[model samples]
Each structure stands twice: as structure tokens, then as C-alpha cells.
Target chain A: MGSVFTPRNLLVAGGFILIALGIWSGEAGIVFEKAIRVCLECIGLG
Target chain B: MTRTPKIINRLIIQVAALFAYNPFLHNFLTGELYRGGSKYLCTPGLNCYSCPAAAASCPVGSLQAVLSGRNTITSTYVVGFLLLYGALFGRFICGYLCPFGLYQEALYRIPGRKLIPSRKVQMLGLLRYPIFFLLVVGAPLLVVDTFGNGTAGFCAWICPAGTLEAGIPLMLTQQSLRSLAGILFQWKLFVLILLSALSVVLYRPFCRFLCPLGLIYGWFNRISLHQIKIDSSRCTTCGACVSSCKLQISIHTNPGSSECIRCGDCARACPHGAISIGFDIPTSQARTVTRN
Candidate 1:
């Protein structure tokens, strides 16, 4: 929709792919849960 | 008109910090950190998942998770989002936004250390890249236990942004949170305090030394739309702007340094107005040098 092959454009596209891959494969959820667990552990909730 | 900028800035500050408070945005609050980021490349900021008000995912945390790769390459959500953000905004995300950067900038307002001379600033500035590579990525895997699990080294141990926004507040309110306090937490919190103190005396110690996002963004500084330029015709090479820069780049020598955040301080400080930030160098802008 805009300029081709710029850093901003590339990164945005890449970011979208990451989000999609993360959600579609459920991999995103795993990372999210793990991250939350680690962070929660910091405060001893985990 | 009088309060408009203040109101806007404050609102931005709140949105950046408190969006999680809204129930509609709660997916961002409770969803996996990488889940939200994998979906949409949220701005790189200190917005925390645990914060009652934060709805956006933390980018660096998301990055670490992806790099560590929980088995396979993880997911597409993060990549898609990052592509969109990086494509649309480039490094502008670092400037004019990002709550953690804003917080550090605010702390820097404490006003003690004079902006260091450009030469020394340039010398020390080289350290940020290696730190970004080693601490942000390498440390996590290397520091992992026999279970073959890794930690988000930067977030778990060093990032002041996490400490200031997530760790401290959560710990202060929940008494049971005291159980989480350990030697590692205390040690990391101490690092946060040191960075906070440095922010008062210096400018963005973390951004300059340890921020992976800044490391990423800084790579695009020269090509980014919002860029810094030296009006070569106007420049006397007196180096005043160089000394004035908190990021410590030699505007006279390298006007478009990767480390330059395009903060406008150098442009504003120039006696001859020899520096300007824009998409391209100005062929004709005002040119004059005055007595010191």
C-alpha cells in the first residue's frame, strides 16, 4: 500500500507475520504464558 | 491552546501506561506477552503485561521469547506485527512515544552531569551494540540451567523499565509478593536504581548501553524518514552541538549517526543553526556563526 522495501515497511510486515505465526500455531501463547510465568516468579506468584 | 500540548502529552503518557485498565483491552493485559506482540507489533516501550493499565505487549520481552524459540521458530504473530510497525514507522517509535523512554527522559530532567564532550561520548557509545548482543540474547541461553530452559536475561536481570513499572508496583501492593523477593530480584532492582540515578545525571543510560529495541531502531537512523542532517554550508565545525548532545555523537563529523535518536537537542543547541533534522539535508537554510 506504500513504499516498497523500506525499513519501516519491512519491519511492519515482519511484525505482522510474527503475530500471525505466533497466534496461528499457538506458539505465541506459549511464549506469552512462559513470559508471564517468569515475570510472575519475580514477585513469587509463579 | 495553552494546555493542548500538555494535555496531549499527558494523554499519550496515560495511554502508553494505562491502556490495560480498560476491559476491552484486557486481551493485551492477560494474553501471552508474545501473543499480543506476535499479533501486532506494539510500540517498543515499558508497558507491562502485569500492569493493571497496560494493554500492549513489551517488544523486547517478545523479542527474547522469539529468539529463544520455544521449540520451533514459535509463531507468526510477532513477526507480522513487527513488520507492520517497522515498515510504517521505522525508528520514529523511539522518539515522541515509548513510555519507558519518556520515563528515562523525565528522570534525566534532574539535571546534574553536563552533556559529555563529543569525543569521549563517541568512545563510550560503541559499547551499546555488544551489550545488546550479549546481554539481551546470549546471556539468556548461556545462563540457563540443566533443564535447558533460558531466561529473558535483560528483563529478568537488568531492565530498569521492567523494575520501575512492573516489579516495584506489583511488589509494593501485594504483601504475598514479598515471597518473590530474592537475591536476584534485589540485585536486579539495584541495577534499576543505578540506571534511574544515571538517568538523572546522564541521558538514557539504558538506551545507550542495553536497550535491544534502541539497538534495532538505531540501525535505521540514517535511512529513517525523520532523520538528522548537517547543513554543511552553515557548519563552522565549532563542535558546540557535539558537546550539547546527550547521546554523544559528533554532529560535525557524523550528522546521521546510528546512535542519534533525532531528539532535536543538537539542532536546537547549534549557535549557527547548522544542524537540522529532516528526511534529507537542507541545501539552503540560515547560515551564521556568532561569538561564543
Candidate 2:
């Protein structure tokens, strides 16, 4: 097996780190709130 | 010699992802969107959250929402999720998972005069970058109203997937929604109709030219963990792979080009057994072909 320090693995690690920060910052709750409510704009009402 | 198994596997995954992304079957009957816990997460594909049966949110929609709303935390999360998906699978998500992609392919299969993309047609693909930057990112972040709030410009204005999957279906089911139909809805209908007509001749016109999510995923195709690999030593340069590609990509010349959706058509077409798709480490190739 090659080293885990490949460019691809590094990007994946960065993604995970960002996700953790976002979650800790309560971003998931915000996504949940926005998602649960249907945006009429999306239905072309706007 | 039959590519049936590979085709069937991809088909199965496409159908399964379609249903799995929209599993709240009862919501379809009620004309209500699913407000489940899963809504917090975004689907890897372009399934609209407004679709009554959608179990999760659309990543593009979520990103736009967070951007327009100026919610940095949510923006971080949405970008991270998309990055993870892009890094892991690239546009394999488009080839084997997206409901919209499947729908377009089915439309293309309708017997008719097929149009192979010309050079000018291929040039039009450059439009997606502007669309991604302006509609998906810039407009959402910069265009604000009196309330100092921005809109999800792409979803509101251009997304044919939302129009087909959510708007039209919701309008058909709910009388109130139908009554609310205005010029915008009519315009969306026109866009959807035009795109559907075009899809009959040209393959995946939206993914090639308009889909911001597809563009984002394509950026990672060159470096994604799962990718298409070509063994130059095994290749006979038969050109079967190029002909088989509906997207008009040359896999042997550029094994993991950003334009490639990793659909495995090239691999299946390679009579020499030169091309393969998966996690290939310690990259090995005998020669690189130069196009003239």
C-alpha cells in the first residue's frame, strides 16, 4: 500500500475536518431548518 | 462479449438511488414534502428537496440556501459534504446515482436522429463554469432584497430538475399550488419541455452544459479516489472506447478527464482489456497517446 499522504487522501481529510467544524458550529441544525420548510421559489412560484 | 451485467448493475444502482433519495412514498399522496431528520443531510445527486418523496435535501439547493442566507456554518458543512462526495466518487455519482441523469439517458434512448456533439457543441460546456459561479454562487451571495436576504437564484430560475421533479408534480397534485402558477412556472415549463426535446437528440445536455453540481463533481474526476484507469501496455488503440462513449470522451488519451462521468462505457468498449475503473494505486501506464 502507498502512503496515506497522497493528494486525494489529504483532500478527504480536509473535507472531514470542515464537516466537523460545521457540525460543531450548529450548521447541521440550520440545514435541517431550511430543508424541512419547502421553498416556494424552488417550485417556481417566485 | 455482452456488457449486460455492467449495464444492469449501473441501472439497478440508478433506480435504487432514485427511490432511496425519495423514500417517503406517502408524502407523494399527501402532496407534502418530507421533513425528516435526513433532510439535514444532502443527497449526493441533484434530487430536489421540494420533491414530495425526497428524503434528503439537494446539495446545490442547500449550498444556495446557506450562501443566500449568509450562514457561514451551514455553508461550510454543505461545501464539505460536496467536497467529500467529489473526492470519493467524482462524477460516478452522475453515471450511477442521479435520478435526473437516468431520466435524461432514458430520454436519449428514445429512437430518433441522434446528434453527436460537434466542436462548437463541446465549447458550450464552458457555460457551466459561469452558471456555477454566477447563478449558483454569485447571485445567491450577492443579490439581496430590501430585507437584506438573497435568493436561491438557480433553483428559483433555472433548475429543470426541480421543475420536473417537484414543481410540476406538486402543481399536479395540489390545487393551491396550481392556482399559484404564474409566468415563472410557465417559463420553467418551457425550459423543461425544451430540454426534454433536446435530450432526445443530444445526450445529457444539462449535465454537460448547465448542472452546477455536475461541474463541481467533474473537477474532482482527475483526482478522485475512484477513477477510470487505462493500462497503455494493454491498449491496441482500437478507438472502440471513444465510439462507445455517449459523452464523447476519449478514455485512452485522457483516462480521468474532468469531463468523464466514469460510466464504464470506455472500459466495456476496450476489446484489449486496457481500461479499468476503480481505486488503482501505484499508477502504471506504458505510454500516453497524443491527439493531433
- In terms of lDDT, the best-performing candidate is 2
lDDT of each: 0.59, 0.84
Candidate 1 residue lDDT tens string, B123-202: 66566666667766675556565665656666776666667666776676655666758887787788888878878877
Q: Candidate 1: which docking quality band?
A: acceptable
Instruction: Give per-residue lDDT, candidate 2, residue B271.
Output: 86
Candidate 1: C-alpha RMSD after superposition: 6.9
Best by DockQ: 2
TM-scores, all candidates, are 0.73, 0.93
DockQ of 1: 0.36
lDDT of 1 at B135: 64
Candidate 2, residues B163-248: lDDT per residue as tens digits? 98889878988998899899999988888898899999999998988999999999899889777767789988889999999999
